[model samples]
Target: MTTTGPRVEEGYAPVTGGVRMYWRSVGEGGPPLVVVHGGFGVVEMFGDVLERLAAGRRVVAVELQGHGHTADVDRPFTWEAFADDVAALVGSLGPGPADLLGYSLGGGVVLRTAIRSPEAVRRLVVVSAPCRRDGWFPDVRAGQESVSSAGLEWMRRTPLYEAYAAVAPDVDAFPALMDKTGALISGDYDWTDEVRALTLPVLLAYADADGIPPAHAAEFFALLGGGLRDAGWDGSGRPASRLAVLPGRTHYDVFAAPELAPVVDAFLTAGG
Candidate 1:
């Protein structure tokens, strides 16, 4: 279902703050698949999986503001702001609707984008996403402290520090974003009963070791079961949002593990 493939370089002139974004493309055909990275992550973390996805479809992975290669925002960070960045980027690059894949923070952003711009998304893949009222939100203060202590430069010197370094400078502004993210997570998108509004095939993937435990992820997905069932199927099938607990894996491993590549590939390509 998935295999490694060559990559193509692509650059875009950002509409917001003129921040230039560096994105990589994989594969040559099928619907475009876009990937959004988690907090402290950029495209490189998922490069291998992107390459594998590219073998059958176009895979575009971009850095969020203040992380990876994207420039820092002049304004504060918020889920709305991040979602706006993703919306703008996708809008600028689009030839048509594209498949969307997001993880952790990126996964939340993808959900926001789907609600904000439902028309632009085709298939949606979310890994370790915190659903409405899920009560799992990363603490901005803790993240800020982590980034501050390590120092971006110090982090960059070591392979593990790369992502932390990317978001380090703006650590002070994290609290507000964390608050906003928390509100979204606890309010169920403020609709509480509009899962059908998204109206798109969604593949919910959870990592056993994620910030939100797999059990919690399953609970949130259960709320959306009605919509999935209306769409006809079970788990990733719809009747129930699908659940996969990557054995001995953490939140990041579900997507980045070398051994799980084949599983991920199969999920993305299934029912295609």
Candidate 2:
């Protein structure tokens, strides 16, 4: 893929926890969509995929707490903290109930945002994120668990490092980013109750080959009141929530999957 990112108007919003979160905007239409990248990622990492999502409406992409142009703060990484920051930024943008899309670590953050501040969100798209830590395959969970500064020396040569280095305020903090993210993902969590209570429309889209098992996805859908019974002739029986497993995608590259934008766009527009 050509990896051409969108041309954005960049800015920052001083959100919770004394952090000035960095944000980039594309398009100029109403009711913006907020896009959050995976851990150790910057906005540009989504490349043209984000641009494509911005087709007719605005897309606001954020660099959370310590990633990319956003500098790290004194606080440790926590889902609630990040979610509050995101919620604050969403309100700052306008009197919004904006559409939200998040990938990987971002997915967890937005999930909390939708839970904690449902009024601030209109529709949600969760890509490659698990409600519980164990929702991930044991091997993937092992990788997340085993991450440590000492154990990640080899990552200096990977795209994760290069992407951060390109625009991070403190490039050397890559290790710290890894450390915090490692600790964050390594923690135990089960958000089933919270997810089951969400009243907003959610699109639980993932790669068919994702680290999260298909059974887990079905369980998540069922929790959202989906897949329990048949949709009648007019599809009225289908749950408000939607589930998609895009073929040929894995957790690693599903963010930029070609099939992603269409479903997400359809879900967002369909809400109107």
Candidate 3:
């Protein structure tokens, strides 16, 4: 519904984590790509950029618990819980596992999906998301920490709130979503070993000026066995996983950046 070109197809997945997740699709043919949005983000947040990503493929997007058209449930929010719901949705859409993409918080979710339910994922794409809690800049971490303490009136005035109010099942539940997200953000995690153990191909995409530093991005790539080899002239030595740092973008806007779709498409189609 947020896109400009493609005719959107909407539906709801069977109950997961006590919420019947809402999902939508666009485009036709080619491999399916399932996209998950950042925190406080709805399917509509993808806006027109989804049109480009949907080209030559069918793109499926989901609204996590309490976000967008999905009604908030009593359960708490956690990366693993969201991943389970997404994985189930992916399975529901599949004759086989689908390629997965996520932005920021959603990036973390899909990463967990690949790790927890590899059978339901073909390839992975993580945009502006960090695998470890410490990957974020100190200031960014500070901001997440302050979310629970931030006044509701102040948050209600934000664009995030406005967007949520536009499509949320319960408009008054915005504060609850914020509180849950704050708790999710405050969690401490280190997925280095898990990522290192992954057998499926992965793509890590980031903006040049992101909440995570380029050094941390390199560290993440290194975990996937990237950046440690010559990758030879023929590129045979390079790891199938990749790292891309788009110029002229930041974490907040990278999801909609014009350059993102081609990069993701290329990765999804590489060596096919």
Candidate 2: which stretches are off by over 4 Å?
1-7
Per-residue lDDT of model 1, residues 1-272, tens digit only? 89743758677547455556656677677577889887657687774777767777778887776665665655554566766777777777667777788887788778777777777787777777766534354563244334442354454476544454454455444343334334433343433355445667677777667666666666656665633345435434344234566767777567686644465556667667
Per-candidate TM equals 0.74, 0.96, 0.96
Question: What lDDT would each prediction earn against the true structure?
Answer: 0.64, 0.89, 0.89
- In candidate 1, position 116 carries an lDDT of 74
lDDT of 3 by residue, 117-136 (tens): 99999899999999999999
TM-score of 3: 0.96
On TM-score, the stronger of 1 and 3 is: 3
RMSD of each: 5.6, 2.9, 2.6
In angstroms, how far off is 256's CA in candidate 1?
0.2
The residue-by-residue lDDT of candidate 2 on 110-198, one tens digit each, is 99999998999999889989889899999999999878787567888888888888888888887788899999999999999999899
For residue 169, what is the lDDT in candidate 3?
74
In model 2, what lDDT does residue 100 have?
91
Candidate 1 wrong stretches, greater than 4 Å:
1-7, 132-134, 137-160, 163-196, 226-241, 259-264
